[model samples]
Target: MSVTQADIDSAATTLSTVIRRTPMIASRVLSERIGCEVWLKCENLQRTGSFKPRGAYNRISRLSDEERARGVVAASAGNHAQGVAWSASSLGIASRVYMPRGAALPKIAATKAYGAEVILEGSTVDEALVSARAFADETGAVLIHPFDHPHIVAGQATVGLEILEQMPDVDAIVVPLGGGGLLAGIAAAVKARRPDVTVVGVQAAQAAAWPQSLADGHPVAAASMNTMADGIAVARPGDVPFAHISELVDSVVTVSEESLSTALLLMLERAKLIVEPAGAAAVAAVTAGAVDLSGNVCVVVSGGNIDPLLLSHVTTHGLTAAGRFLTVTATVSDRPGGLIALLELLRDLGASVVDVVHSRVADDLYLDEVQVTVSVETRGPEHQRELRRSLSDAGFLRD
Candidate 1:
């Protein structure tokens, strides 16, 4: 079950018709921040909106005619299910996918839309996987594992092949780690071809199992914390993938939810790209000072299927983090001219108000003063500070 360059080449050829040759995009803004030639591998633009199709198609394409007739079953949070369903549909095989109940709605809809029987089960991917395996045993369908199979690993290696082909002299490649299909595949190809290039894996800090498990010499999940990167929220890395990771991966890094959301929002706004939290983990890691990035480093953006509601929140979160948006309270005299003066001050600083909360009864405000809670958007921290200075100069006291 060893992955090789031949496996990658085969995967690339097989997936040519099924999957996209995801773009290798360079980001000057990110490059300057990380002091590296930052290139973003846009798997977010791939079929099924993620790199999962690469592995899924590779595994399904190898099925025997008898196996195809028998059909395929898989368990996933969302991406793997969509990948399997998409691949199976193309091969005219009946596909059944099990997903955790809390999986994203968009992923669930997309997978079902791809012509698969979607089954919601359990509270976690691990639990759904158990159910999927049982269902496969009962139905005589092939169980297509998300990341623990050789075919899947070989398929994911196609991403690495594409990276090297796109940027032959890339100094490092950063990938988000889940069960490690992407990392194992990329490591296999990159190490087999150019061992000198570093291959690093990034994980959500809230789900940093690999590094902690490696530190303990065994798999041990981290404490639970909310993260936007659900695609990488694996409780543990696959044993097979961990072996390759141990030997081939240069290092594993973890980035916080704040960092991931910030990066995701940056991709959407500045880079003019939409990236899901898991897909943005590599960039998040770079922003969080994970990689020793200083040369040409390529970050794999693995997916872009974020829900619209969540996207709205992430955008605000990012703006707040970068100091482009500020929230503060000001107390002005309870007179019409007082509020107008504050508005004039904001206008002078070129700040736009986003929200306002008013209270006349708060003890924080004098009987003759009104407390106004303001959320304003500015250019950056400097602009925000300048705006605050304007308020001070205008004789409006900030609370």
Candidate 2:
């Protein structure tokens, strides 16, 4: 069934007490960077740390007495699992969540902590769906499709209602596109209310499906999904959400891994927001110039359920991309004071060495020469260039 404004409104009403009204705040930093009056719809702060619970709770709460008794089953990479688990726990329903074997450890633990029977079944969400469907059939439980159900779409649409209520002057809404639930929900709500306002969707370049799906006028399966933004790395878009997207979304754009990392770091450092890679997709699009930010734009930070290890790696990647960190190898004389001289030079250049490695006996090294690799912190790209120039002027052979 087609989701309408009334359905979305009904969802908002149903979810009013079940979900948190996530904040929509102005972001001067993003505004200056994107050349617009940028606002952040911080769904990252929502209950279950995402927008997923809105849909999960809305759909689960509507289950008939018989259906609730039968319980529910679902598959997800991470976010949706937590949502369903939390919703079922709240409603006193037994829930089983089939998650990818490689799903984030924190997510798996969180789902189980929320009282769902967590089963790590496959390597990808699509493969996990096979197990979830089988479980539903075996147990006679209702299967909750993450983004395919009308109730789920209607529920996720509440975010759009909040956005319009929170920022009436908003000229555009940028959302992260995975299976297309969040984008479709927002698009339907915004387009139905104010067709002039643009609705843009962003996806990770490595795992994007909507671009190809849109081209084929159907849900096209991506050949492979690989990216740090694992939350949005769906193999295919949901048919239900795809229909809304096809009718309402203005544009779909893809952002690179580097861009996603950079955006996550930007949110953490500048906006003081701890955003996951998927949650940062909208910001990535704006920073990467993948979308037009000519007017008052609202970028939805969809979730903040990133694993600590992934966040650390993304932080390093972001620093490297920003040119604030550098690794340089230099050939030096194999004397005791040779390393001292090099380090002194680096100190003089105002470079803080974070790590150092020395290799004396190597195929590439001469008998009298040693290879010294140093990782250092710099002010930025210009400071990095200055350090390189200093090293060159000091007669150190850079490798």
Candidate 3:
């Protein structure tokens, strides 16, 4: 069933006291970079660290007394799990959540802390969803889908309503797409009120399904799903959101893993905001030039529930992708000052050494030669190329 503007209005009223009206902050860095006035819809700072609660609370509040007595079941990698659990607990309903085995520990802990009976099952959200569906079937618990129901869509559309009120002159709205609920819902609400505004959806290139599905005029499963943006690594689009997305969303684009990491890093460093890879997808498209957006553009920073370890890894990856980090292996004479001489050379070349590993024993190394691997920080691509040339000129680089 299609969600309407009135449905979104009703959802806004339902969530008026239940959810936080997240702030919309102007992004100077992004505006200068994208050659447009950019505003960030900071749902990352919302309750449960995401916009999921807006939908989750709205959906659960509408459940019949008998359905509420039956409890609720949901499956998610992270954000949605916390949303459902927190919402259910607030409404005095029991909740059971199924999550992938490899789901972030912090998310699992947060889910349990919100009073959900957490179950670890399978290796992906889709697999966990299978378990959740079976549990719902056998236990008579009401199943709360991540993004496939009209209530959920309507609730998520409240975000769109807020954006319109916050930025009446907004020319475009960019949303991170997974199962398409947020994108579709926002598009429906914004388009219904401001038909002149453009709505775009961004997805991780490694796990994108919307582009192909839109082309085929139906939901098509992705052949493979592997990305650091686990939150949006949906294998397929939900039928409910697909219908609205096809009609309301102006365009859908994909951003690379490098772009995702880079955008996350930018948000953390420049905006002083912590956002997960999936949450950074919209900004990734803007920064990577994946979408041609102009005028007053609002990019939704969907969620900030990221593991610390994953954040560290993605930061390093982002630095490397941005040409700020360089790693190289070279052959140096196996002498006492051999490693020191290499370090001195790097220092002279204005490269800050971050890590070093030296070994003399190697299958291809000569008895008098040592393999030295070094990771250093550089200014940019030009500095990296200059460092490589200097190393090669010193006869330290091997073929």
Question: lDDT by residue for model 2 over 1-399, one digit each (tens)?
Answer: 689888998999999887999998888888888779999999999988999999999999999999999999999988999999999999999999999899999999999999899999989999999999998889889999999999999999999999999999999999998998999999999889899999999999999988999999999999988899988999989989999999899999999998999999999999999999999999999988998768889999999999999999999999988888999888888987999999999998899999999888668777899989899999899999999988888767655
Per-residue accuracy of model 3 over 136-241 as CA lDDT, tens digit each = 9999999999999999999999999999999999999999999988998999999998999999999999999999999999999999999999989999999999
**Any idea what lDDT model 3 has?**
0.95
Candidate 2: residue 198 lDDT (0-100):
95
lDDT of 3 at 77: 96
> In candidate 1, which residue ranges exceed 4 Å CA deviation?
4-6, 360-370, 388-399
Query: Which lDDT value does model 1 have at 252?
Result: 92
Task: Name the Cα RMSD for model 1.
Answer: 2.4
Report every candidate's CA lDDT: 0.87, 0.92, 0.95
Off by over 4 Å in 3: none
RMSD of each: 2.4, 1.3, 0.8
**lDDT of model 1 at residue 136?**
88
Measured by lDDT, the strongest candidate is: 3
Stretch of 10 with least lDDT, candidate 3? 1-10
Cα shift from native, residue 274, model 2 (Å): 1.1
Q: TM-scores of the models, in the given order?
A: 0.91, 0.97, 0.99
